[model samples]
Target: MTDQPVTYSADSRLASIWSAAAASWLPPITLILAIVVAWEAAVRIFSISSFIIPAPTEVAKSLVAQWDTLMQATLVTAGEILFGFVVSVVVGIAIALIIVRFDWLGRALYPLVVLFQNVPKVALAPIFILWFGYGLAPKIGLILVIAFFPVTLSMLAGMKSVDHSLLLLMNSVGASRTQILFRILVPHSLPSLMAGTKIAATLSVIGAIVGEFAGASDGLGYIIQFASTQLDTALVFAALLLVSVLGVAFYYAAEILERIVVPWRPKFNDA
Candidate 1:
């Protein structure tokens, strides 16, 4: 007798679909809603002044009212972060490649990387300002320094972690180092690279803001600084809210890109 494939019933299919959807989105959505509700309740229950901690409603109104200026600052900050991040990625990957390919280079230069990474970036802000002379350059340089390490370390580790078996096989087949690196090492390392990129995405914002705090006369950080000095806590909170939204948006954007790039990652299981 021929074996017939067993098919799930329609009810089972519906249940599985709903379960998958819930597993994918329920946790984060619930947590966000809960936090918003709790925040609103706390401000009301304690009779907290807006200056102390603006209500979510107040923040929302401020967001709408200051959308134009806030948005302009956001765009400027985004531009610096994006430009600096891209520069870091390119330079970091190139450095990683050089180190991985040449043991002497790694031994000679990797320690310097460690030294640089160890230095508190904020401490270097004044030096950077002196060197780059305010404007966009200092911010760009700061962001690059902040973002570069993750990419470098992650790429180096990823490149070096290529399977020994694969390398041996390539050697036996007389595959050139370049071919092996391009065909095997890079593909294997993409996940790690993506992880570094995700980290760099967040750090980039911090670096830009810090740089602004040190020198720049524009950007959200400048707004934050000015607001704080004037005791405009609502405006500070408004700028902070903008920064938070930017970080979330940028991180999730990187996450979406990672998923697209790494489609082999397993999805939620509904069974």
Candidate 2:
């Protein structure tokens, strides 16, 4: 009798990958479907008015009916989110670097940063609208304010938490401050930065909506406001659904970017 090693064929490997992917997604999808079903049943049994609490089906119908308007608003909101998030990343990283490089600056500015973060973002939204008017600028500014802290804090923590032994080794090698920062600290900080960026991405959406709510003629937030005025609860629900989808989509996009940039880092499942 001879013994043979078992090996997976290419098709088998692909099938396994697909199965794993499906298994990972199935539970969440099932839960969402169950909730929708229950919601539909409850609305029908209670004879609920669409003006009060629209069923998922009504929301879906509203989505289709208002697709054009929703898409235009979505584009506007998405642009604000992307632009604001980018600004937040650049400014956050620069601030992080400055604070890390200067002990005095870090000591002086860190407290102010924490204090600023403690301020209610919603309160600031109206002020931003007042300053920047009912334009994209205010929404972008609000998003930047809301999204900035997480990335900055993450980066600072990451840079500060680098192994002291590594710093010592770099010192032994006579590595310059810039070299140590670029080669060691920045790389070490990427994982934390990405984590913060994911959070910031979601927050940016909320910030934009808040700004729109404060003062805007367009965007999902405006749609929600208008729908409420019209008592079109289905439209409100539809817009809310779109916003939720947008936030999740943005979050996953950041996650994908993180994976691309930090390929060496373990994935969420692995961790």
Candidate 3:
């Protein structure tokens, strides 16, 4: 009898954890299953040709049959995405810092930075291919351009949003510029930077895939393009599903990393 309360408490804790997890995950899982069922029913009812629109089962079969090729392509695409994302974050943060530190430079150059982003990335891909060849170089180059804008823009906003009064206090304390930057500015801007990372993460995935679509010897995008030409819509759908999963994975990775970096951020109750 003495140990019963402790056992009950442990059981209650386990139950609460499962409840929280289900509350978070169950709706999306249920929704996806519902959509899959509806999709299957619609295809059957209409007798839709697989080439016109693959049934979910057809896509599943394609996924299984092409798993080896798909896995290799996924790895190639993941490398491109990760390389571009890391570089973009570093380059974007550096550029934002430089612009922030040099007030006159920021005024003169920030508009140009914004202007560069307006140029269509698709248009630039060919030029990058010409310059960098058909290797990962061209893909990474394009991804960098496509993904860096949001990080730089968001970081600038966060740094600029810091309280002016706090800057004055730091200035009065004989704090070095480096000290001010890392200790005050960086910390203050972290949340905004993290928000940018999420955007950049997804963009990295998009840019790599799109780059491949434009022209690549490998990667999921290449598979998608080839499948389309052959009218293998099932394979195309499988590739698209893989790309979606990759994007979602990258986005959630950023979200999880943000938690580690900014543990103070609050979590809302799923209930």
Candidate 4:
């Protein structure tokens, strides 16, 4: 009798797990299917020309036809995003640490940071091209500029959120500033850091594409420009899909990293 109840309970738990998984995945899958069907039907029913708007099937064909070229461009753009995002994280953390350590410096430099943050990165692309040329340097520079602010802001918020009593307690124990930063502040700020990273991921992609738009030998943005000029609307759509995938991939990567680094983060399950 005891074994029977235990086995039944285990089965119920497994069923619940499966149900939750399905619930989480079903809505997005259904929405994507609906969009694809509506798009295809609208194009066929309206006698819409493929030049103006390619149907989902037409986009799929272009994706297959130009897979090699698109993949090459994607690889270049991915390298720029990854390299620049990593640099931004490092620089952002350093800036946040400095801000937390010195109140006077943070106050003085924060306005300057915010000022530069508001400057449209695309508007400065020409200057970057003139200065850094058509190489990856300009794209990397743009990505760094666009992505770092959120990280710095998030880290500062997280550190500031730490309890004042904890700080006083540490001071009473003669803990050094460096020790407090590493031992207390860094750990506390990790969740906020990851949240900023997720935001930065999408911005980094935009920055890279905008940089490519100004001047690039090759990238998804370049492909989009060339395809549009050639009236290959399907190809443009195909490139756009790849760009979306890249942005989603980076965002999910940040989410996964957060789960690994902050396993104790709160979860909100539906009632």
Candidate 5:
């Protein structure tokens, strides 16, 4: 008289998974398409000058026409962002570890870190260019400076947030400081680290652009600046679109890495 248990077939399970994925992606895609359509329509209906605001079609055409130049600029910017982000991750994590391991160091340095972060990053760009010259070094330096704070702060918070009870339990077991740090603190801090990484990724792009704006012969920021002088609004929009795409790509790449590294945690949106 027991009821039979329900079981989903493999095909049905896959179909359900795909259905859920589609449901998640559909709204955003649809909205973007609608916006593009509206934008195109508005420009046409109002006879808006492309110099003022390029239509989506005009932007798309410019993107294709200038693909070579745009791609090279994008690559220059991407390289700066990638290098800067890597340096930030390494240096930030190292600083966080030192801060957590040494109370005196944390007390001595954390305030300075916060104060430096509060300083206008844009102002520093000029100084960096002056010191490092108008080369990739300055751009990478700017990105590192801009991206470093978030990761360090997030890791510090995560390390400090570790449950005292857990620490006591580990201590009772005679766990060494290194073991406790590796086994507990680092694992617990992953979510916060990933969160900071996502922020850093977006900021890295901004820092690169700012550096380029201050002084650069290449990169998307340079392209935008050059186009502005010519009043080539469509090219400006096209370059901007590339920057937006790069930022989104960098963000999602970090998200994917977080998922791979910390599979136990829920996806960011889910949480």
Candidate 6:
């Protein structure tokens, strides 16, 4: 009546909102909630013993009740992961630089790198525990081993991916090696490095847990082992949940850092 186009109907607006919400999170949330409900129902309906498989509610209760202990274990695990991850980044970058700097070194050592990378980190867990002793050292060492290869490989690939024309342009300008590396090579490699960091973050947690499982007196890995031995299924679930949260949190933290550092990376309109 006012000569303006009609607005969307209430139903249409509601549907639009619902669609957006669903697009944002409903699928994953529904799936997770459904799984939890199913898990709880299965345990109750089958009369499963808590010692065998705990209900989700029971695990949540256990987590709440054992908050202090779980928190301490979580802190220890986080410390180990952080230390290991830092070490891996430093060592990985150093190795990548050496390989990229010297062609002879790359040719000579790349095969060994591939060979070691192929070897499962779990296989070396025991050896690391043996060498570093049954302490945080072994756990951190294994974390370093697990995370380092991916970072090194990703960085090397990134460095090599620099455009030939760009390289030539830098050379034409007689740019110093350090200047070219800092301005062009590093920026070009940032996306790859972030991807590698995310993978490394997850693997570092696994490595720390495996090392601790081998032999350790503290941390989430130790808590999991202790829970298993006592048949505390709820506690085991609690530990696993904590580990999952840790991995996700670390991954997203890396992603945030990547976004902050690499503004050139494309941002989606939806995002």
The best candidate by lDDT is 2
The candidate maximizing TM-score is: 2
Candidate 2, 1-271: lDDT as tens digits: 5598556789977887788888889999999999999999999999999899999999999999999999999999898899999998888888899888787997898898899999998899888888989999999889888999999999988888999999999999899998999999999999999999998999999998998999999999999999999999999999999999999999999999999989989655621
If scored against the real structure, what TM-score would every candidate get? 0.86, 0.93, 0.91, 0.92, 0.92, 0.88
Number of backbone collisions per candidate:
0, 0, 0, 0, 0, 0
Backbone clashes counted, model 5: 0
Model 3 misplaced regions, further than 4 Å: 1-18, 268-271
Off by over 4 Å in 5: 1-16, 268-271
Assess candidate 5 and give its TM-score to the true structure. Answer: 0.92
Pairs clashing in candidate 5?
Answer: none
lDDT of 1 at 210: 95
What is the lDDT, from 0 to 100, of the residue 152 in candidate 6?
88
The TM-score that candidate 6 achieves is: 0.88
Candidate 5: residue 170 Cα off by (Å): 1.4
Structure candidate 2, residue pairs in collision: none
Cα lDDT tens digits for candidate 4, 76-167 = 99999899888888888888998888889978888888899899877988899999999999998988888999999999889889999999
Ranked by lDDT, top first: 2, 5, 3, 4, 6, 1
Error of 2 at 45 (Å): 0.7
RMSD of 6: 6.5
Q: 4 or 5: which has the higher lDDT?
A: 5
Supply the global lDDT for candidate 5.
0.91
Each model's lDDT: 0.86, 0.92, 0.90, 0.90, 0.91, 0.87
Q: Candidate 6: misplaced stretches above 4 Å? A: 1-22, 268-271
Q: Candidates ranked by TM-score, best first?
A: 2, 5, 4, 3, 6, 1
